[model samples]
Target: MFNSAVATLNAPPVSIVLNWKSSYDGANGALIDMSQAVPGYSAHPDILAALAKGASDPALARYGPVEGDPEFRSAYADHVSQLYNAKIDRNEVQITSGCNQAFVATVLALAGHGDRILMMRPCYFNHESTLGMLGVGIDYVDCDDDGGLLPNCASIDAAIGPQTRAIALVSPNNPAGSIYPAPLLADILALCQKRGIWLILDETYRDFMPLDMDVPHHLFAQDDWQSSLIQLYSFSKSYCLPGHRLGAIIAGHDVVAQLAKVIDNIQICAPRVAQHALTPMLTSMSSWRQENRERIAARATVFRTAMDDLPGWDLLSSGAYFGYVRHPFTGVGSRQLAETMARKAGVLVIPGAFFGAGQDGALRFAFANAGRDVIVKLADRLSSLTL
Candidate 1:
């Protein structure tokens, strides 16, 4: 039989959207998919060449170091430290199969059946479900819709209970791409430090933000940071390597050691070939990656313009890869409405309810995958929606 997490998640609603996308296939209808986190583009050619080299090496066929190959770990730690100006050593980082695995390891490291984790409402759905399946209590801190879905430190402060073990937040958030300003992030970090709880910050979308923006939160540079903070990341977005599935967690060396124990059973180690291959690129291909960031920023501009064309729909918050839009619909649920739109409008999207129950009034459009022309079609689709 399947587990409770499997039951609760009920398969990502994107699957249902995909089914509708399939049903509506036609040469006449436009197909713009904004449902999943998958990158619409491919990795750089030089990166592929490295992958080919790694694949052909007979030495890579064998099992790798469970902590991650030393070369990759060193490269990752150094890159993150230099970018964030955080003092991190190779021992403080643990490479995981991907961001999901990094999150799983962090949860396992910190909480259990009866312990609690505070999550912001309209959170990434998988975080809620993961804690639920573990029988860990997930308490939601209500975010103000008027202010955008950015986490308010006071609400977060109110959510911390005696049993609370940690707080989990995703910046350039999944459903709402609202970037929490550095001051707000610092406040949350201070609360966690005061309460002696962990702050699990998911920075998967951070790479897409304007690189010159002020700090990506100063939690990393704070004194005694490792004791109260655990940061998670995915190479999937930044490196355009989702299928390769490589990610990492940076915390105290002690916490890293604890997660290493969990990783022992969950994966034994991250995919050896990908980690080994990504090592050199992390160091050598900085400029290429920056160009990709600029490209995504351009796509964000196109999406903003497309949303501007659709007057009835409200473009709530656009950040990184996602645009959280409030459709003009009133009565119908987002799932049913999204399904109808997917078929009729010839575009696929994830309903807001999939992200969190009370989020039904909105929908998430992962606009980064589609280019300008494809995103422009969103206006037509919005105009066609009956709701």
Candidate 2:
């Protein structure tokens, strides 16, 4: 029998959204799928070659260190050190199957049954579900449209209870796509330190942030940062290799040692083939990553323009890979609207209700997978909807 906590949860959002596709008859046009946040483009040729070479090698098929491949961890540590202008040792890094697994391992290592983690409303669903199945409590502070969907440090500070073990957040957030400013992040980190709780920052989409923004934050450079901060990242979006399922955690050496126990029981180690293939490419693929960043930025601009002055749709906060939009129907729930849109308008998106409560009027459009032309056509499809 399944656990009640896990059994009571809603089905996976992406899988539910994809199932709606079965109702579409293609009457409107070619389906524009803005549901899942995957890179629209294919992996780089060099990366593909590396994967093939690594997969074919017999040695890479053996078990690796529970933390990760040594070369990959060192390569990633160097990459993080340069990016954050901070000192990071390879020993402080732990690679996992993906960012989701990274979160699971971090939670298992840091908190337990009845311990709470503070999260923003409209938080990533997977984070919520992960906590639920573990019997961990979740406390939320709402991030509204007026505040650009960023949580206030004072509000977060006030929400922390004695049992709260950590504050988990996603930058360039999943459903809202709102990037937290460095100063804001610093303020929140200070509050977390003051409260004696962990700050789990998920930076999965950091590589696609607008080019003009400064470094993500200076928290990594602070003395004793390792005591309170844990940063999570993914190689999937940046490298267009989600199927490879590679992610990492950068924390204190002690924290990494603790996580090794959790990860050892969870995965033994991340996929050896991916670790071997991506180790050198961390440095080698710099320019390629930058180019993709520019491409995503261009797509964001086009999406904004396409949504501008639309009769009912309001583009709330958009950047990175998503546009959080308020739909026209006032009383209709986003779940129903989203399904109707897919079947009639041939446009697929995730309902905001899936993200959290009080989100019935909104939809999360992951425009990263749609090209500019496809995005241009979105306005018309949406406009034609009568239901």
Candidate 3:
């Protein structure tokens, strides 16, 4: 009566965390939620105005092209090309319902039931779950070390087997928030090119990178980079429009065409109203997005400072939107500690085990959504934990 594969999946991570948050209602203190990575800010007023206008436009009520709204495709491509200083065209980009959908479509197009995808350990759990349900082999290459969450070229090279079809990675990584250095990305890209395997780079948090960091990586500038690189992006974080569910993929024109078939069967096209609303803001709202980036950076700084003085906990990595910390408890698993924090301290965070194996002692805090005062209060609550 139901899909057995779906039954094997765990409950969604964010929802579980949200449930924990709900347990603290009317408690002694404010509940500080650091579970899900979502923008704390609202969409720009101008973007909101555009969305209202788009909603009222009767033309958008009809079905849109399966690929995307032509206006959105063109606008997004131009925006990406200008940001990366690369040669990108509308034909090379495909808009999807969200980054998750973009990833799903790419996986379906690139790998079959038994084929493998190399994922960095401490992966975004949704990616792992998606591959599991598809019966695609997930070969995890551990990125955790004294050096942090950056990919090791040697480890990544050794993980590739004949069945491996691609290497998937997320930067300003979801659980740890470690931004891979550009040189390391170059090395990984070269290795993929040599092996004739695809590099699926999920740059969902690219817009939140430090203002001084300028560009995320130089892979886009390489000759024929599209042959080895498939980049995924989300407008949700940058534009504060997660509810709109807009995301995209940038690849070779040929690959985009292949994605069209998978996407057509999935959602036909991304939401039309948001696509129409976002097309103009891609260029017009650049400065507003930059301000949001700075705001998140400030939050990251506050979290780092709060963790620095903690007696037992260790801040393993902090950037973009997350802070991965090793909990003080020696015997307790991460899930238990997370629950304890929620029920006892009114602070909610995701257990590290949700991200990958061998991570039972750590927890990931999505600190971007919490402001400085909330973060300070969170630190006080965490400090009060006896274990």
Candidate 4:
């Protein structure tokens, strides 16, 4: 009785991974779950305290502005402006329930069924699923073997067809964890501008960039940047507030106005409690968030070292919270291997096939969820795998 898009879509990755958990019987310390890229630690006490205060405020219990709390719009605008070193205004921001919603709303606003959205190979699976349900066509901008699907102007030009409406990219990308370079990002944006297509950038992991590479890109500094750019962000990762379901969209006033309609119809408004809670702490919590970034980066180093010693495993690309690994078995599909790994080795990872096609032999390690010591144990488990 379901629609073709929903029926044709693959099984949910998390559900598939969780199913494997039942067979797990490894004698190792405990299950080392590297599945979801959630925060490894608790939200900062200050944030929790703020949340409590916001929850206690009866004024926030009622419905909020569909455009979002005006105070948060202004705060997030200022946050992005200072963070990206670009001039921004509150009018450009629209709060959403999560970055996923930000993406869905933006995608619906810009394109319709049969319209094309150009994306990178081995993309975040949810983006693919969302487009599929909407009956939108997906075209690819291929990435190299090194990890990131950084598209040059020529590649992007070749990928664009008559139906292509936008190019969507995720940096510190999900599944692969490749961070796109600044110059390359600028070039792609320029191409999108020339083509008169929107460039939808999802920077959910921007906070976790390595210290030397703090700023992810410089697109916002360009003249008339908003006309061609639609940026998506998440306070969930940065603030450890995923349960709060808070995210934002950065676009021109016209785009924000359009998004208001989408948000009004879908969510009416993002969760009001979290919006009120975070409004006061957005600027104040930067140093704390920076400390968490450093911690995650350090965990990345531990994960990298562990992968290096594994006989058959190859680390393809790693950044932020994820590592895309090429498993040793040549002919085995990733789904079967992932299941076996979960059962025998007591390790949990998502098979690469869930991300996109031709990804049968790879796996995505959401390594940031595990601490340094747990990451070290990953090497031990894989080393013991007989396959």
When summed lDDT is taken over every stretch of 10 residues in candidate 4, the lowest stretch is 142-151
Residues 178-231 of candidate 3 have per-residue lDDT tens digits of: 999999999999999999999999999999898799888889899999899999
Better of 1 and 2 by TM-score: 2
- Clash totals in order: 0, 0, 0, 0
Per-candidate TM equals: 0.96, 0.99, 0.98, 0.98
**lDDT on C-alpha atoms for all candidate structures:** 0.85, 0.94, 0.90, 0.90
- Candidate 1's C-alpha runs over 4 A off are 1-5, 211-214
Look at candidate 2 and give me any clashing residue pairs: none
Encode model 2's per-residue lDDT on 194-310: one tens digit a residue.
989999999999998888974888999887999999999999999999999999999999999999999999989999999998989999999999999999999999999999947
| Model 1 agreement with the true structure over 89-208: per-residue lDDT tens digits | 999889999998899889998998889999987889878878877788989986767888786777788889999999999997887888988888889899999999999999999888
Clashing pairs in 1: none
Q: Say which candidate scores most in TM-score.
A: 2
Alpha-carbon runs more than 4 Å astray in model 4: 147-149
Give the CA lDDT, 0 to 100, for residue 89 in model 4: 93
Q: What is the descending lDDT order?
A: 2, 4, 3, 1
Off by over 4 Å in 2: none
Q: Candidate 1: RMSD over Cα atoms?
A: 1.5
lDDT of 3 at 116: 100
Clash total of candidate 3:
0
